[model samples]
Target chain A: MKFAVIVFPGSNCDIDMYHAIKDELGEEVEYVWHTETDLSQFDGVLIPGGFSYGDYLRCGAMANQSNIMAEVKKAAAAGKPVLGVCNGFQILTEAGLLPGALLRNRDLKFMCRTVQLKVENNNTLFTNHYEEGQVINIPIAHGEGNYYCDEETLAKLQANNQIVFTYSGDNPNGSLEDIAGIVNEQGNVLGMMPHPERAVDELVGGADGLELFKSIVKQWRENHVNN
Target chain B: MKKVKIYVTLRESILDPQGSAVKGSLTQIGYEEVQDLRIGKYLELTIGDTDRDIDTIVKEMCEKVLTNVVIEDYRFEIEEAN
Candidate 1:
C-alpha cells in the first residue's frame, strides 16, 4: 500500500518516516507537502514528528491550520489509516481528529530517549500485529508530549477500547494515565508521541515498530485484496 | 484603529508544568508567599479600521487559530489605538 508522509515546514523527521516505509517496509511512499490538497490517492497517511511551524503559539497549532490538514481530515473520514507520531500526534489532537491535547511535559523539559511501551489494545488495525499487553521499545522526543483530556472523554476512550498504548515503565512526559498512544473511536486514526518509525531497524535499536506498519498493510490487504 | 490584547492560558483543570517550575524557582529565591502561578500567552494585535465588527473579528480569530479551546481559555480586551 502506498503511504503519504505529510511534510510541513520545520518537519525534521520526514526523511526518517520515508526511509522506514520505503526502505524497511518496502512500501511505496511519497512526501506530500502541506500545501497539497488532494490525498485521495494514498492508502495510508503518516504524519511524521518534528517541530512543525516552529511550535509557535503552541505545538502543532499553526500546522493544523495548513491547507493539507483538511485533506488529512478527509482521509480520516474515508476510513484511511492515519498514523500521527510526535508533533503529528499534536497536530491530530489540535485538528480534533484525535481526542485530547498534548501539553508541555510535566517536568518542563524536552525528553529524548527510548522508552518501553505496552500494547494496551491489540485488536485494532494499528496494534493487531503486537501481542496483547506486550512491551516494546520506542524512542520519544518532544517537549509537549503530555496528553490530557477530561474525565468524560477518558471514560469514552476507555469504553471504546481506544487507548492503544501506555507507558510500560515510567511515564516520560507525565501523560494522563501514562497514555503513549491512542486511536479514534472508529479505530482508523492513531496518534502517538513515540517515534515508532525511528525503531524499525535492528541496527538502530529494535524492529518493534515494523509491526505497526505491517499491521496496517495486512489489515488493508485483508479488507481490500481478500474481499 | 484598535489595539486588541489577547490572553491565553491553560485551563485550570490542566496541569501547567512551566508555571509549576516558575513557582519552584520563586520558592527557591525565598518568595514563600507565592501561592500559585500559571504561565500563559499574551498577544497584542494592532488592527486598522475595518467594516467588520472588531469584537467579532477578534473573537473569531481567537477561536480559529489564536487559541485552542480544547485545553486553553482565551480572553481579549480592545483599546483605542494610540
Candidate 2:
C-alpha cells in the first residue's frame, strides 16, 4: 500500500519513517510537505515523531493548524489507516482525532529508552498481527508523554476497548493506566508515544516493530481483494 | 492597538509535576507551609482595530490554539489602548 509520511517544519524523524516504509517494508512511500492540500493518492498515512514547530506553543499545537492536517482528517474519515508516533501522536490529540492529552512526565524528565508494551487489544487495524496480551519492546523518547483524560472519557474508552497498548511491566512516563497507544473509536487512527519506526530493523536495534507495518499492509490487501 | 493578556494553566484535575518540583525546592529553602503549587503559561497579544469584539476573537483563539481545552483552563483580559 502507498503511504504518505507527512513532513512538518522542524520534523526530524520524517526520514526514518520514509526509510522504514520504502526500504524495509518495500512499499511506495513519499515525503509530503505539511502545507500540501491533498492526500487522496496515498492508501495510508504516517506522521512521524519530532519537535514539529520546535514544540512551540505546545507539542504538535502549531503543526495541527497546518493545511495538511485537514487532509489527514479527511483521510481518517474515509477509514484509511493513519499511524502517528511520538510528536505525531501529540498532533492527533491536539486535532481532536484522539481523546485525552499528554501531560508532562510525572518526574519532569525527558525519558529516552526502550520500553515494554503489552498489546491490550489485537483486534484493531494497528495491532491485529499480535496476540492479545503480547509484549513488545519499543523505544520512547519524550518529556511530555504522561497521558491524562477525564474520568468520564476514560470510562468510555475502556467500555469501547479503544485502548490498544499499555506498558507491560513498569509504566514509563506514568501514562494513565499505563496506556502506551490507543486507536480512535472507529479503529482507524492510531496514536502512540513509542517510536515503532525506530525499531523496524534488527541491524540497528530490534525489529519487533516490523509487525506493525506488516499488519497495516495485510489488512489493506484483504480489504481491497475482498471488494 | 489593544493588549490582550492570556493565562493558561493545567486543569485542577491534571497533575503538574514541574510545578511540584519547584514547590519542593521552595521547601528546601525554608519556605514551609506551602500547601499547593501549580505552573501555567502567560501570553500577550497586540491586536489592531477590527470590527469583531475583542472578547470573541480572544476566546476563539484560546479555545482553538492558545489553550488545549482538554487539559487546560484559560482566562484573558483586554486593555484598551489610546
Candidate 3:
C-alpha cells in the first residue's frame, strides 16, 4: 500500500505523518504538494495537521482554496481513502469533503494536551479495529477545534453512522456530542482534530494511534488479496 | 448597494467552554446575574449591487470558510442601509 501526505504552505505535521508511515509502517510514502494536481499514483491521501495558510481568516480556511484541493476533492468523490488531522480536518470541512464544521475552542485558547476519545462507531473502514465505546488517547492541539452543525444534520450523521469518534469523559473542545472525528457519507474520508500521527510510536509516549494506520493498510492488503 | 449580516453560533449540544470561563470570571468579580454566556461569530459584508443574491454568497462563504457547519449553524440577512 502507498501513502501520500499533502503538504500545504503552513503544514508542520507532514513529516511526522510521513515518518509514521514510512519509518513505522514500512510503507512507501510520498509528500504531495498542495499545488500538485496528479494523484494517479497514490493509494491513499493524508492531510496532516498544522496551521495551514497560517490559519488566516480561520483555521484551515485559506488553505482549503489551494490548487491541489480540487484534485483532493475529486479523489474523495471517487471513494478514495483520505485522512485529515487537526488543521487538515478544518480544511476538509471547508472543502466540503466532510460534513459539519470546526469552531473556535470554547476556551478561547489553544488547547494542547492528550484527550480521551471514544470510538463511537467502529463499523466504518477507519475504525474497524476499535470496538464501539472503546476509549483511545490522542493529543488535540488547536485554538479552533470546536465542531458545529444543525440539529437536522446532526441527526442525519447519527442515523447514517457517519460519526467515527467522540470525546470521552469531559468534552474537550465543546464539539457537538464531543465529536472528535467524523467520516463522510461514503465512509472513505475522515477528518479529526486529534493528532493520531503523534502517538503512533511508543518512544513518543504512546502507541495507541498505530492501530489506525495498521487497520487501514491491513484492510487495503486484504482487499487486494481477495480480489 | 446592499448589506448582509451573518450570525454563526455553536449548536446547543456543544459546550461553550470559553463562555463558561468568562462567566466564571464575571462571578469572581461579583457579577452573578449572568446566567449563561454563549459565543458566536458575526460577519457583515457589503455588496455593491442592491439586487444581487448576497445570501447565496454569504452562505457559500460560511460553508467554504466562514463557519464549520459540523458544530456550528449560521443564519444571514440582507438589507438596505438607511
Candidate 4:
C-alpha cells in the first residue's frame, strides 16, 4: 500500500515519517506538500510531528488551513486510513477531523520522553495489531499535548470506543483521562501524541511501533487485496 | 476601514498552566494578593471596506481560524479606522 506523508512548512518530522514507511515498513511512500490538493493516489495518509508554521497562532492552527487539508478531509470521508502524530494530531483536531483540542502541558514544560501507552481499544484499524489492554512504549515530545474536550464529547468518545490509547503509568501532559491517543467516530482516522514513526526501527531502541503501520496495511489488504 | 482587536483565552473549564506559573512567580516576589492569572492571545486585524458585514466577517474569522472554540473563547472590539 502507498502512503503519503503530508509536509507543511516548518514540519521537521516528515523525514522520520518517510523513513518509517519507506525503509521500516517497506511500503511505497511519497512526501506530499501541504499545498497539494490531491490525495486520491495514496492508500494511507500520515501526518508527522513538527512545529508546523512554527507553532504560530497556535499549535497546528495555521497548518490546518492549508489547501491540502480539504483533500485530507475528503480522503477521510472516503474511509481512507489517516494517521496523525504529535503536531499532526493537533492539526487533525484543528481541521475538525478529530474532536477535542490540545492544550499546554499542565506543568508548562515541553516534555520529550518515551512513555507507556495502554491499548484501550484494539478493534479499530489503527490498533488492530495491538492486543486489548496491552501496554506499549512510545515516545511523546510536545509542549501542548494536554487534550481537552467538553463532558458531552468525552461521554460520546467513551460510549463509542473512540478512546483508543491512554497513558499507562503517568499522564505525561495531563491529558484528560490520560488520553494518549484517540480515533474518530468513523474509526479510520487516528490522532496521537506519541511518535510511532520515530520508533519504527529496533536499531534505534525499539520497534514496537511497526505493528501500527502493519495494521493499516493489513486492514487495507483484507478489504481490497484479499476480497 | 476598521481596526479589530481580538482576545482569545482558554475556556473556564480548561486549566492554564502558563498563567498559573506567572501567578506563582508574582506571589513569590511578595505579591501574595495576586489571586489568579490566565494567559491568552491578542490579535489585531485591519478590515477594509467590503461587501461583507463587519460583525459577520470577524465572527467567521474567529470561529474558523483566529481561535479554537473547542477550548478557547474569543471576543472582539472594532474601531472605525481612517
Candidate 5:
C-alpha cells in the first residue's frame, strides 16, 4: 500500500515516520509537501510530529493553514485514513479534522520521555491490532499536549467510543481523563500526542509502534481488494 | 472606516493553570481576597481601506487559525479610531 507522509516547514519527524513505514513495515511511502493541493495518489496520509512553523502563534496553528490542508480535509471527508502524531495532532485539531484542543502542559514544561498508554478502544482502524486497555510504552515530547473539552463533549466522546488512548500511570500534562489520543467520529482520522513512529523498532527502544502502520496498511489493502 | 478590537480568552469551563499559578503567587505575597483571575490574548486590528468582511474573516481566523475555539472564546468590536 502507498502511504503519503505530509511534510511541513519545521517538520522534523517526517523522515522518522517515513523510515518507520518503509524500512520497518516494507511499505511504499512517499513524502508530500504541505503546499501540495492534491492527494489523489495515496491511500493514506501521515502527519508526523515536530515544531511545525516553529510552533509559532500556537502549536500546529500555522501549519493547519498550509495550502495542503484543503486537500487533506477532502481526503478525510472521503473516508481516507489519516494519522496525526504530536504536532501533527495539534495541526489536525487546528484544521478541524478532529475535535478537542491541545493546551499547554500544566507544568508549563516540555515533557520528553516514554509513557505508558492504555489503549482505550480497539474497534477503530488504528487500534485493531491491540486489545482494549492494553498498556504500551511510547515516547511523548510536547509542551502543549494537554487535551481539554467541555463535560458534555467529553461525555459524548466517551459514549461514542472515540477516545483511543489514555495515560496509564501519572497524567503527564493534565489532560482531561488522561486522554493521550483520540479518533474522529468516523474512526478514519486519529490524532495522538505521543510519537509512535519514534518507538517502532527495538533498536530505537521498542517495536510496539510498528504494528500500527502495518495494521493500517493491511486494512487499506483489504478494503481495496474487496472493492 | 471603522476599527475593531478583539478579546480572546480561554472558556470559563476550562482550567487556566497559568492564570491560577500567577494568582497563587499573588496570594503568597500576602494579598488575599483575589477571587477570580484568568489569562487570555488580546489583538488589535486596523482596517481603514478594505471592503473585506473583516468580522467573518476574523472569526474564521479564530476558529481555523487564531484561537483554538475548543478551549478559548473570542469577541471583537469595531469602532472609529480615536
Candidate 6:
C-alpha cells in the first residue's frame, strides 16, 4: 500500500519516515507538502516528527491550522490509517483527531533517548504485529511529550481498548498513566511520541518498529487485495 | 485602531511543569511564602479599525488560534490603540 508523509515547514523526520517506508518497508511513499489540500491518493498518512512552525504558541498548535490538516482529517474520516509520531502526535491531538493534549515534559526538559515501550493492545491494525504486553525499544525526542486528558476521557480510552502502548520501564515524559501511544476510537488513527521510523534499521538500533508499518500494510492488503 | 491583550494559561486540572520549575527556583532563592505559580502566554495584538466587532473578532481569534480550549483557558481585554 502507498503512503503519504505530510511535510510541514519545520518537519525534520519526514525524510526518515519516507526512507523507512521506501527503503525498509519496500512500500510506495511520497513527501506531501503541508500546503497541498488533497490527500486522496494515498492509502495511509504519516505525520512525521519535528518542530513544526518552530513549535510556536505551543507544540503542534500552529501546524494544526495549516491547510493540509483539514485534508488529513478527511482522510481519517475515510477510514485511512493515520500514524503520527512526536510533534506529529501533538498535531493530531491539537486537531482533535485523537484525544488528549501533549504538555511540556514533567521535568521541563527536552528528552532524547531510546526507551522501552510495552504493547498494551495488539488488536488494532497499528499494533497487530506486536505481541500483547511485549516490550520494544524505540527512540523518543521531544520537549513536550507529556500527554494529558480528563479522567472521563481516560475512562473512555480504556473502555475502548485504545491505549496501544505504554512506557515499559520509566515514564520518559511523564505522560498520564505512562501512555506512550494511543489510537482513536475507531482504531484507525494512532498518535505516539516515540520515533518508530528511526528504529526500523537493525544497523542503527533495532528493527522492532518495522513491524508497525508491516502490520498496517498487512491489514490493508487483507482488506483490499481480496475484495 | 484597537489593542487586544490575550492571556493563555493551562487549565487548572493540568500540570504546568514550567510553572513548577519556576516555583522550585523561587524556593531555592528563599521565597518560602509563595504558594503557587502558573506560567502562561501573553499576546498583544494591534488591529486596525474594521467593520467587524472587535470583541467578536478577538474572541474568535482566541478560540481558533490564540488558545487551545482542550488544555488552555484564554481571556482577553481590548483597549484603544495609542
Model 2 / residue A28 / CA error / Å? 0.5
**Clashing residue pairs for model 6:** none
- The DockQ of predicted model 6 stands at 0.83
B1-82: candidate 6 lDDT, tens digit per residue: 9999999999998888788889999999999998889989899999998999999989998888778898999889899998
Off by over 4 Å in 1: none
Ranking by DockQ: 4, 2, 1, 6, 5, 3
lDDT per residue (tens digit) for residues A1-227 in model 6: 99999999899999999999999989999999999999999999999999999998888889999999999999999999999999999999999999999988888889999999999999999988999999999999998999999999999999999999999979988899999999999999999999999999999989899999999999999999975
lDDT of 3 by residue, A88-185 (tens): 99889888888777877766778999999899888877777778888988988888888887788889999998889988898877788889999999
Shift in Å, residue A3, candidate 2: 0.3
Tens-digit lDDT track of model 3 for B10-45: 767777777788899999999999999877888888
Worst-scoring 10-residue span by lDDT in model 6 chain A: A100-109
Q: Is candidate 1 or candidate 5 better by lDDT?
A: 1
Q: Which scores higher on DockQ, 2 or 3?
A: 2
Which of the predicted structures, 4 or 6, would earn the higher DockQ when compared with the native? Answer: 4
Q: Give Cα-based local distance difference scores for all models.
A: 0.94, 0.93, 0.85, 0.93, 0.89, 0.94
TM-score to true structure, per model = 0.97, 0.98, 0.80, 0.97, 0.93, 0.97
lDDT for each residue of candidate 1 in B1-82, tens digit (9 for 90 to 100): 9999999999998888788889999999999999999989899999998999999999999998899898999999999998
Q: Which residues of candidate 3, in runs, are more than 4 Å off?
A: B1-82
Instruction: Provide DockQ values for all models, in the order shown.
Output: 0.85, 0.91, 0.49, 0.92, 0.74, 0.83
The candidate 2 chain A region of ten consecutive residues with least summed lDDT is A218-227
Cα lDDT of candidate 3 equals: 0.85
User: Candidate 1's residue-wise lDDT over A1-227, tens digit each?
Assistant: 99999999999999999999999989899999999999999999999999999999889999999999999999999999999999999999999999989988888889999999999999999988999999999999998999999999999999999999999979999999999999999999999999999999999989999999999999999998954
* Candidate 6 local Cα displacement, residue A94, angstroms: 0.7
TM-score of chain A of each: 0.98, 0.98, 0.97, 0.98, 0.97, 0.99
Docking class of 1: high
**Backbone collision count in every prediction?**
0, 0, 15, 0, 0, 0
